[model samples]
Target: MKIRHLRNATALLTLGEHRLLIDPMLARPGSIPGFKFFGGGRRPNPLVPLPPDTFSWLEEVTGVLVTHPHPDHLDTAGIRWIREHGLPVWTSRLDAPGLGKRGLTVHSLEDGALGMGVERIPVRHGRGLLAWLLGRVSSYYLAHPDEPSVYITSDAVLTEDLLEAVERLQPDVIIAPAGSANFGVGGDILFSVDELVTLVRRAPGGVVLNHLEALDHCPTTREGLRERMKAEGLLEKVLIPADGEELHFARPERARGPAAPGPGATQERERASLASGM
Candidate 1:
């Protein structure tokens, strides 16, 4: 499998013949409003533009995997592009209907949906009312017979149940949000640096960190994160890819059996549709 990191939370995941675009935010830089609402330092979002070769990459996308309906994850430009390309969109049950209303083909991203072993793991976008207002989001674990298994933790805070899922699944690669984003209040909405350290230590295989240096709210920088990882003796285990970079993974010698969706951290699939963080 090859994962081509495009931009913030947007990547082209290749599993065998499938090239699935994950959470596309295809807007030009500064088109979206700033996300940092307090404590100053707010600027128009998408701090940087997509890579020069982004259009070439999009031509190969067979489908899209949306983790949520947030603007940063799936903005207006991304929606229009998908429609123009006539591509199928796979997402959690909670997000499928809303995405379909936006005029894109939508399908459930559950186990057995895409000719692969898929598991939908629910996660908390933040704590207390912030999480509630952020609405429901999900992480996906995909296992293909000819490719390595991967767990994509779409925006989430640290939680015991999530760690348990990691321990249980033991995916070959883990792609997590490392932006440590906050609206300048209510603590961090994504994983803190310390939490990321802990997570790296626990991961059995390589861990790819994204969601950095692309948004106004996400304070984590790739250079700073790399230095911290080096300090923590995790440089070998973690990969902080630059925009437009790609990483390849092959199935290990000890591959596991077919993946089954766990009950996951949260079971309440029904929730309000408030994609608050724009």
Candidate 2:
């Protein structure tokens, strides 16, 4: 399996026969409004531009996986690109209808969809009112017969469910958002540095972190994360890639292990969604 770290929260994940583009935040620098809505020092979003090879790399995408529909994850440019490509989008039920409305070819990402060992783990974007406003987010675990198992923990604040998923899934690679985003008024919405330390310590294998130094709300710096990881003796397990830097991991040959089931999590989401009549 190859996980190319394209840019903040965006990745080109190649697993088995799939080249899934994860979270296509393809806007040019300063194209979108700032995200630090309540933050006093808010600046124009996407503090940097897509790396030079982004356009070319985008051509290889076979499908799309949206963890959430926030502008940073699926911006106007990203939406248009996927529409043009007519690629299938694998995502949680929450955002499927919305994305379909935007002309995307949507496929719900329930477990075992597409014949891949899949698990949809629900995540919280923030705590309290901010989380409520952000609504619910999703994390995904994909285990293709030809690649290592991966857990993509979309934008989330640490929660018991998340920790449980990590413990249960035992993913070979974990791709998480490290932006540490926060509207000035709320506490850290994304993972705080301490939380990331804990997350890395607990994960089974490598951790690829992004979503830093791009937007106004996300204050965590890559340098800072590196230092902390180094101090915690976790640098070897962490890959803090630059905008275009890519990391390649060998695909495991043994695909016999049963993937951790997320039926418990899915049932909870279904109940919640049904309760809301969504």
Candidate 3:
């Protein structure tokens, strides 16, 4: 599989025959309002523009995968582009109806949607009142038959549920936000640098970190994250790709073991357990 990191959480994920565009936040720099609500360093969002070759890369997108409806994930420009291309959009059950209402072909991302085993792992985007206000977000585990499995922990804070998912799914590649976002008052809305370090150490396979440097609220820099990871002896296991950088991963032989019982049974159980406070 090949992952081309674009600005923020946006990426061109090449999995088998599919070129899935993950979270297209296509907007000119400073087009959106600032996300930092309190302290200093407040500025319009999307601090940087897409790389010069971003359009060329976008042309290959076969579909769109949206983790949430937040403007940063799917902004006006992104929605316009998708409508123009008439691409099918895969989203969670909670978001499908809303997306459909917007006049796009929306499909719920369920098990076996695109010839891949899929699981939806719920994640908290923040904590306390801020988390509730942010609504629900989900991380996805996608296992293609002939490629390495990938778990996308979309914009979230560290949680036991998240750690449990990592332990159970054991994805070959983990894509997570590492910008350590904050509204300047509500603490962190995304993973802190320390949490990211622990996450990298816990993963059994490669980890890809994104959501850095492009936005106003995200304070973690690639250089800083690299430095921290190096200190922890975890740099080799993690990748902090720059915008427009592409990385490829071959499926490990170990990942080719027999299939699990049902497509998303493990995730279902996990979600149920969490719901029951188990």
Candidate 4:
């Protein structure tokens, strides 16, 4: 599998024959309003533009995966691009109806939706009343039959359910947002640097961090995060790719030991927990 990190949470994820564009925020720099509501540094969003080669990579996208409808995740430019390309958008059931009303061809991402084992892992976007106001977000675990599995933890704050998903799935690659975003008053809407350290430590496979240095509200820098990870002896296990940088991972050879549970097993547990209010 290959993941090319674009600006913010947008990435070109190549798994098998599919090139899924994840959470595209395709806008010119400063085109959107600022997200930092409390702190003084309230500059317009998308502090930087897409890398020069972004259009070339975008041409390969076969589908779009939107974890939510936040403007930062899917802005006007991104929606326009998707409509022009006529690409299929795969998103959570909770978001399908609203997104469909906006005229994009939307599909709910369920188990086996894209010829892969899919699990929607819910996460908190903030704390307390702020979390409720930030709305719901879904992280996805996608496992293909002949490739390394990946878990895309969309914009979220640290949570027990997230940790549990990492521990249980042991995906080959885990992609997470590391912007450390805050509207200044609500504390943090995304993972703090400390939480990212812990999350990377808990992940058994490679961890890819994105959502850095793109928006004014995101304070974490890639260099700062790299230094922190290095101090924690976690530099080797993480990939803090620059915008437009692509990293590849091949499946590991199977061991001749007892077979582990199928990828669908964890999704079943997740669904049950959601149903029971656990």
Candidate 5:
């Protein structure tokens, strides 16, 4: 599978026959408002322009994935782009109705919706009242026969449920936001740098970190995250790709373990061991 970081949380996730555009905050530089609501570092979002080759790359997209309806995830520009291309959208069951309300043709992505294995893991946007304002977010674990399984943890704060999902899914790649974003009034709405380190350390396979340097609220730098991960003895398992960079994920070279018994058993057994290890 080829994963291209399009800027912010936006990406083109190419797996098998699908080139799924994930969370498109498509905007011309300086066209949108800034996100830093406190501590005074506000600047127009998407500090850079799309790569010169973006259009050629985007032309391969087969569909879209909307983890949430927030402007940063699925902005007005993103919506218009999808409509112009007439691309199909895969979203959570709850968000689908709302997207449909706005005239977007939607496809609900519940468990097994992909005709391959999949698990929908709902996540909290933040802590306390901040979470309420951030609204509900959905993360997904997709297992495709043609490629390594991947877990896309959309905008979210670290939580027991998320950790549990990570332990269970055992995805070959875990794509999570690593910005540690916060508005002045609230704390981090996504995983803090420390939390991301822990998440990367615990992942069964490779971890790809994104959501950095694109918005004002997310201040965690890739260098800082690397230092922490290296300190934690986990630099090998995690990847921090730059915007417009494309990475290919190959299946792990080692082989072990018997096939998991029955439906969901692979995930269930993995989760069970997580608690035992803790």
Candidate 6:
């Protein structure tokens, strides 16, 4: 599989015959309001612009997978782009109705949607009232038959349940948000640096980190993350791509079998897990 990083939480993922855009935040610089409401450094979002030749990449997008409805994940510009292209927006069942109201072609991203094994893992966007206000967020484990399995841990803080999912799935690649985002008053809505170190150490295969150096509230920089990973001796399996950078992954050297259940278990177990996990 191939992934082309576009911006904060936005990227083009190629799995098998599909080119799916992931969590596209396509707004121009400073278009969105600042998220750091209580912080002194508050400013309009997207301090930087999308990389050149972004349209060229967009032209090939076959679909979209939106993990959540937050502005930074799927902004107005992104919605407009998807509408204009008339592409299918595959997202969690909870987000489908809201996105459909906005005139999108919504589809539930479940098992067999894209000829892949799918599991939607519920995530905590923040703590307490803030988390409740943020609503339900989902992280997905996708296992394509011909490609390496990937776990996209969209916009979440670390949890024991999440770690357990990682252990069970044993994905060949993990795409995680590394911004350590905060509103300057509450606890971080994304993983902290220490949590990231733990995550990298526990990963069974390669890791891809993003959601850095773009928005006003996301304070973790790529350089700082690299330094921390290096110190922890976890840099070897991690890839922190710059804007517009492309990455490729294959099956791991250790011959772990298919990430998902076999044919006999696919139907019942897949349905059971998705229902209970969410």
Candidate 6: 10-residue stretch with minimal lDDT:
263-272
- TM-score of each predicted structure versus truth: 0.92, 0.91, 0.92, 0.91, 0.89, 0.91
Residue pairs clashing, model 5: none
User: Better model by lDDT, 1 or 2?
Assistant: 1
Candidate 4 Cα misplacement greater than 4 A, ranges: 255-278
For candidate 2, what is the lDDT? Answer: 0.82
115-184: candidate 5 lDDT, tens digit per residue: 6566788898889998988788999887766567788999887888888887766777889999998887
Sum up the clashes in candidate 5: 0
After superposition on all C-alphas, the RMSD of every candidate to the true structure, in Å, is 8.2, 9.4, 9.0, 8.8, 8.2, 8.5
Deviation in angstroms for 149 in model 4?
0.7
Error of model 3, residue 37, in angstroms: 0.8
Computed on alpha carbons, the lDDT of every model, listed in order, comes to 0.87, 0.82, 0.86, 0.85, 0.79, 0.86
Residue by residue across 69-168, what tens digits does model 2's lDDT show?
9999999999999988889998899889998998888999986786788889889999999899999899998877656778999999888899999888
lDDT of 4 by residue, 1-278 (tens): 78888889998988888999999899999999999988689999889988777887789999999999999999999999999999999999999999999899999999888888888999999899999998999999888776778899998888999999888877777889898998889698999999999998888788889999999899999999999999999988888877767777776676321113122111100111212221
| Local error of candidate 6 at residue 215 (angstroms) | 0.4
Model 3, span 1-278: residue lDDT tens: 88888889999998899999999999999999999988988899889988777877789999999999999999999999999999999999999999998888999998888888899999999999999999999899998887778899999999999999888887878999999999998789999999998898888777899999998899999999999999999988888887777777776654353234111111100111212221
Q: How well does candidate 2 score on lDDT at residue 200?
A: 91
TM-score of candidate 5 on Cα atoms, chains taken together: 0.89
Report lDDT (Cα) of residue 267, candidate 4: 13
Backbone clash pairs for candidate 6 read none
Candidate 1 matches the true fold with a TM-score of: 0.92
Cα lDDT tens digits, model 6, 66-176, are 999999999999999999999999999989999999999999998778888899999898788888988899999988877788899999989999999888888778899
Candidate 3: which stretches are off by over 4 Å? 255-278
lDDT of 6 at 78: 95
**lDDT: which is higher, 4 or 6?**
6
